[model samples]
Each structure stands twice: as C-alpha cells, then as structure tokens.
Target: MAQRADISVTWERWQATPDGQTARLFHLTNRRGTRLTVSDWGATLTSFKLAMPNDNLRQLVLGCDTLEDYLQSPYLGATVGRYANRIRGAKFSVDGQQYKLIANEGENCLHGGEIGFAHQLWDAEIIESIPAVRFTLHSPDGDEGFPGNAIVTVTYTLSEDNNIRIDYEATVDKACPFNLTNHSYFNLDGVAGDVGNHVAQINANQYLPVDSESLPDGSPVSVEQTAFDFRTAKAFNQDWRKIVSDQRYRGFDHCFILDQNDGSQPVAQVRSGDEQVVLSLYTTSPAVQLYTGQYLEGTRGHNELVYQNRDGFCLETQYMPDQPNSDCAEECIVRPERPFKHSTTFAFHC
Candidate 1:
C-alpha cells in the first residue's frame, strides 16, 4: 500500500492592516517539500514552491515581496470575488429590480468593484484535521452594490501528492450574483520570465470573444482554426502574432468554455520551458480565463524582477464573464436557498 503523505501548517503575524488589524501569513507544507504561503490580508497566496531534484526550489506563482507590493500589484496571487471577471454596464437586474455596481474598468464593474474581496482582510485559522488554512469574510448587504449579507470562506489544503486544493463556500441572505476565483499568475520556470516557450493545453473547444473593453462581445465561438486553439499541447508563442493581429489584443485575454466542467479531471496543463515542471489545473467552474500577462510588461515582482510581457499566465476558472448580463445569469445568482460552493485544485509535477 502507498504511504499517506504527511502534512503540516503554520501561521505567523505578517503585518498590520491599515485598520490596525493584524494580518497573518499561513504556510502549508507537505513531506515532499512543497510549500504554499498564504496571507489573510486578502486571503491571498504569496508563494508556491516545489522542491526540485537538484535541491533547488522552484516558485510557480507570481507574487510580491511585501504586503504593500501586493496591494499595488494586479491581483497577483489574490482571491478575486463577488464577481471574478467583468459585469457589463456596471449593472444587473435581479427579481425585477435593477442594481448598479461601481465601475472600475471603463463602464463595467471589474472584479466586484474597486474594493472587492481582494482588498479585504479576512479572519483566518489553521484547520489541523485537514491540514489546511481557512479564511473567512463577512460582506454586509449592499456591499459593492450586491444585495446580500454574505458569509464566504476559502480553504487551502496541501496534499502529499503535491496538490493544492482550494475550496470556496458562501452563503448569502439575499439573492446576488456571486463568483470567485484565484488570480494566480503561474510560470513553471520558477522565475517570472517569459512563458511563451512553455507548452500548454486547455481542455476547451469553444472560446468567448471580447471587445476592446475586454468584455464579451457576442456568443461563444469555435476555436478549431483560430489562435485561441490550445486543444493540443503547444507553445504559447505558436500563434502569438496571429492572436495579436486577429484578436487585436496584446495577448491571450479571453475566456474558454471547458469541455468538461465537472472537475473530475484536469482542464488545463502547463509545462515548464525546460520541460522539468508541470502544473495541472482541475476545477468545478464552467470556464477558464487565459491571460498571458500582456499588461505586466513593466511591473515589478518578487526578488526585484521586472516582469516582461507574457512573463506568466493565469488560468482563472469560474462562470463565464459578464454572465450576470448574459443568458446564463441564473448560473451565477446565489439565492437564500441555494448557496455557492466550488473547488479548484493545482497539482504540481516535477
């Protein structure tokens, strides 16, 4: 019989919030030397490192060195919530009543308004039984223009097999549009370098096209003969110029409809440029946003690294973007009777 992997978790006071509250950082480690550092400040993941065969540590996720840096960074490894992506026109109607949201990105509400969950301080505790850390937040009714007093919890668990499981659960007192996802920019190369050479495959046959505002323009379309095709393993730069010219975007910044949204298998796999490390993503969400760090060209990251374009990629699994204004709005609406729950896992192989 295979032995069970031993796991452990620890926490330390990292910094103080602007509100004078103490924010803590939790470390979840496994016997295999895989370590994940998360902070309660935003329920954000600061770092994920794997122990390579050469006794060297390989960092997979892009992050900042300090809490202040994270506050300024673009999501980084933070948890995005209320709504993962954008909501059209910064408004949505529920039960014959129209609600308006704060518009942070053009006329759309991006990532649940300006003060989304990513900027909130959460209460965190270590769950010894499952060897995980649970971060919880309470969002009052009308917060961010969402009509609900919601209690949300995000738990991160590390397993012996080098899988980091993220479980999200939320309950709302009233009907509201709810969606959450982790915006972790991954580069299996262990450094925030160009991921154009990294081989990747996404289990999505259809993709959503976005307009100049990065919002869904129309219905989903086939990716068979387009630059968005990643049905098979290929380097990100395989159709780099084609994507730039055809899509009119700097790089990949689109949503893909997963062929299988059941979370039974990995929906995406990315290999390191050196072909030494691999990351497999499994999620219960229906779609995954593929963003190739186009705007991160001059951003500074951990270790004083100045990130260039396509330095890392994010596979954010969640409901379709602008779903609240689309035909599938019901899929994201959380009622008092029906709560919100989802799980996403990132497995590292070296």
Candidate 2:
C-alpha cells in the first residue's frame, strides 16, 4: 500500500553526496494534507501527491525512480538552462565571435549540451515563510560554451491557491544569450497511462516550421486551416499521427507561436480527465516548445516497464529552437541583454 500522507512533514537526510556531490531532499506538506517531495540534485521535482476528487490522491507528474535517473533523465522535471533547446550546427556567432558548443543532439547542440543544469548539483534552501524550496545553481562562464557567469535560481512555490509556480531569475556578468525552461513531462491523469485522450489548447494561431532534425528550417506559417491549429481545445491524438508525416518532428515536437500573449500572459492550457489538472503556461519569452514524447518508452528501468511514446507531453517555454544562426532565415535568436525568465503555473481542480 502507498504510504499514507501526513500533514506534518520532516526532512530526512536522503543520500546527500550520492555521487560524491552535495545535495539534499526536502519533504513538504501543508495543513491541507497534501505532500510534495523535492530534491536539490538537479533541482528535480521528484513527486507531487495531492488529494483528488472522491477522496483519492494521485501523482500527476512523470518522474524517475532514483537520484541517478534525475541525473540522466532526458531532462525530466528539471530546470534546463543556458540554451534550452537545439542550436543548429552546434555553432553560434555571439558578439562578433563564432562560438562553438558541444553537439549532443546529433549535429545540433541540445539542452545546454551533454552536461546541463539537469545533471548538476544545486544549492538548496527551504524557506519557511514562503513555504517553498528554492534551488540555486551557478553556471560558470562558458560552462556550456555559452559566455557569462550566470547565477540562476529556480523556486518551486506551492501556494495555498493550489498553484505550483516555477519562477526563474538569471543575471549574467558577461553578454551571452541565455534561455531557460522546465522539462516536466506532465501526465495529469496521474502518471499511470498514455495521455492521448488529454485535451490541450494553446493560444497559437501558427507554429514554426522545422526540418527532419527538429530544427527550424524557416519562419512560422499560419495554422488557419492547417492541422497544426491548436487555437481551440483538441485531443492529443487527433492530429498528432497525421502530423507524424511532417518529418520536421517525425512525431509531435514543434514550437508554437502563442497568439494570446502581450509577451507577458498565459499562453497555453492543458487539462486531464479524472484529476482535472490544469496547466497554464505564462511566459515573457517569444515561443514555447510543445513536445509529445513519441520516444519515451520505458527501457531498462528497475521495474522493466517500457515507456512507449505519447505517455507524456512537455510544454517548454523558451525563445526558439536552433535560433543561434537563424537570422530570420531559420529561427529568431534572443540577444544577450535579456536573461531568460518565465513563470508557469500548474493548477489543479477537483
């Protein structure tokens, strides 16, 4: 049986310095009888068990089994940084100098390269008043081939409003492009089944067109009558299979240009049945990457459960993918002055 949740919580010394690296785990619970388990190692949200309708509870996020999983999970539930998505050719001309990065995603530099924030150990602080856990990681100058000594802070604030707000703030000492996003593949149906029936709505009238490598090939085209439209709420599998022929994604990974943003407002919404978990993404960034995990089959885990495609989805808020050398020909690269910062609220309703 699952351990019964207690309103009172305690912090156990759960394997700090597991990989000869310092990290800590904190268990937080409020008076309402809900519980959240978090770890500073990769700043990953391990689990969120909340009370659901019919007096039942559920874990609404797809997570890993161990600390090592958090260290090597494609980017699961971690705050991905520096450059969140792919950069074409693993090279970008920054400040008149062509800077090269480690290419981990085939020919592209993906998710800050092979060793990103998701694999780093972070500094943790539990603020009692804020009733939240804040994880901090300092990315050294040129850590991921991106300039600047960036000091980043990711705060997981679980409010009484039943909102999990992930707030990011980063300031670089040098002029280098910075973009951050959370790679939490949410399965609001409680991490137990495929989310194909889940409904989603993005305020996007158009989406950036990409190539076979999942890299932007050109500008975004209008979704007016196309199948890329998500202007209204629609089922996940409705057009995804048809879109597989797009070749750009080869599946369901594309950046949607949101229509309902003044550059600072709610841009997308995701809902699940049985739990009614509503995820609203609000960002000051230009684009958001919507990826339906068509390749996340559970493989070689302790349970031997194969994670097939489309079990979860990711709504990564960022500038754009492969924008470093885009220059309007491909993607839009964000300048240095603007350090990436955005807030996404995951709310639940019974």
Best by lDDT: 1
| Sliding window of 10 residues with minimal summed lDDT for model 2 | 1-10
Q: In model 1, what is the error at residue 60, expressed in angstroms?
A: 0.9
In order of appearance, the predictions have TM-scores of 0.96, 0.88
Clashing pairs in 1: none
lDDT of 1 by residue, 5-50 (tens): 4887878888777788888889888887888999998889889989
Query: Which regions in candidate 1 have their CA more than 4 angstroms from the true location?
Result: 1-5, 245-249
Q: Rate the local accuracy (lDDT) of all candidates.
A: 0.88, 0.72
Kindly list the per-residue Cα lDDT of model 2 for residues 179-269, writing each as its tens digit.
7888877778876567877888888877988777888877888878766788888877788777666433334689997765444557888
* Model 2 vs truth, CA RMSD: 4.5
